[model samples]
Target: MHYQITLAREVFCEGVGLHSGKPATVKILPAPENTGIVFIRTDLTDRPRIEAVAENVTTTLRATTISKGNIRIFTIEHLLSALHVYGVDNCYIEVNGEEPPVQDGCSAYFFAVLQKAGKKIQNKFRKEVVIDKIYRIDDGERFIIALPYDKFRISFTSLNEHPLIGTQYADFIVTEDVYAKDIAPARTIAYEKEIKHLQDMGLGLGGSLENVIVYNDAGWINKLRFNDELVRHKILDVIGDLRLTGGIVKGHFIAVKSGHQLNTELAKEIRQGGC
Candidate 1:
């Protein structure tokens, strides 16, 4: 039987948030069994602790944000994705700002942190959710296809208006080693035209060529980590958002032109007491 697990020791890091663009230091600590993943906002007076669950997700614009009453944390998908890959069942994540640092716009940094901190098995059996049927969700231009499987897997197809990024695809069966090599290093990407629009919406304030892959007709503004990185990044975000289901989801999720909103909705649908 698989046991629940958490970090063996504390891990600390700091950087600029992808959304708020504010500075933040995160302290990740081990938690007891059944605690789930919780984010504590140390900057607030009340020090609100928000749970990472589909219902608590407050925003899904370019990233996922979870809130509880007066406090909210932004751009947490990357860290969550790392936790999922490592099979971390419980953790206490404390942050000093409103959003998590978006290092290189990928899950690699978080994976390193968790890897360094190590894993400690808890005394309780880890909970798992097995898909019992086909679950589908669509938002007009995009949709998700979730099918019963014995592993957490994904196949993503991304279509963009950019000439160089006309069509891209990614597929994976998630595991610690597999994810770290195949998906964790893929950086978040955006088109050249969306910069001004995103900035106007008060998003991507800390964005730069150093952290995000900015593409246009000219091609990768910062060079390529993977030629099909755009689609792989989409799968990374999907992996992150789906972790909000609070356990491992045994299924193959096929997403097309989907973002955080659709990802969280699919998690929400399956989480309404499972398949």
Candidate 2:
């Protein structure tokens, strides 16, 4: 049987929040079976807890945000992506600020932290969502679909107006080794024209060439890590956002020009249909 898993011990990391531009430390701690992934807002007076789930998702702007009452955590997709890869079901993510640190705008650092913490198996069986039929979400120009499969898999097609990033695609089967190697290194990205608008809107305040890839008229502002980094990052995002359905996804996800909004919608639909 596939057992549930959590960290063997707590691990801590700190860095800059992509949007808040503030430094925050995140503590990943193990929890009892069935605890799920809970985020603690230690910065708040009452230290409110927000469970990581689609229903709690408050915003799908540049990144994903989950809220409970007044407490909200921003830019959580990267961290969640790492946790999903590790099969981390029961854990506490204690954040001392409004957001977790953006580690190189990818999940590589987070994956390393998990490796350091190690994994502890719980007696409880894992909660796996097996899709028996096709579930789909579609917008005018974007769409996401989950088809029946015996294991978790994903294929993403990215299309942008920019010539440098017009079309890119990535396909992968879910595994911790595969994710840490292939997905975690794909950084979040933005275009040259959007930088100023993002700053004026009070977003991406801490972003730099250090943490985010800036695409311009010519090409990527910095050296390329993966030729199709944009599309790989899209797959990373969908995996992170789909963690709401209890981690184990036993279906093939097909996404086309979809972002956080459509990903969350597809996840919600899958949950409602008994996954």
The lDDT leader among the candidates is: 2
TM-score of model 2 (CA atoms): 0.98
Model 2 residue runs over 4 Å out of place are none
lDDT of each: 0.89, 0.89
Candidate 1 at 53: error in angstroms?
Answer: 0.2
Estimate TM-scores for all models.
Answer: 0.97, 0.98
Candidate 1: tens digits of C-alpha lDDT, residues 143-246: 99889888889999999777788899888988888899989999998888888999899999999888999877776778899889888889989988988998
Residue pairs in steric clash, candidate 2?
none
Candidate 2 yields a Cα-based lDDT of 0.89
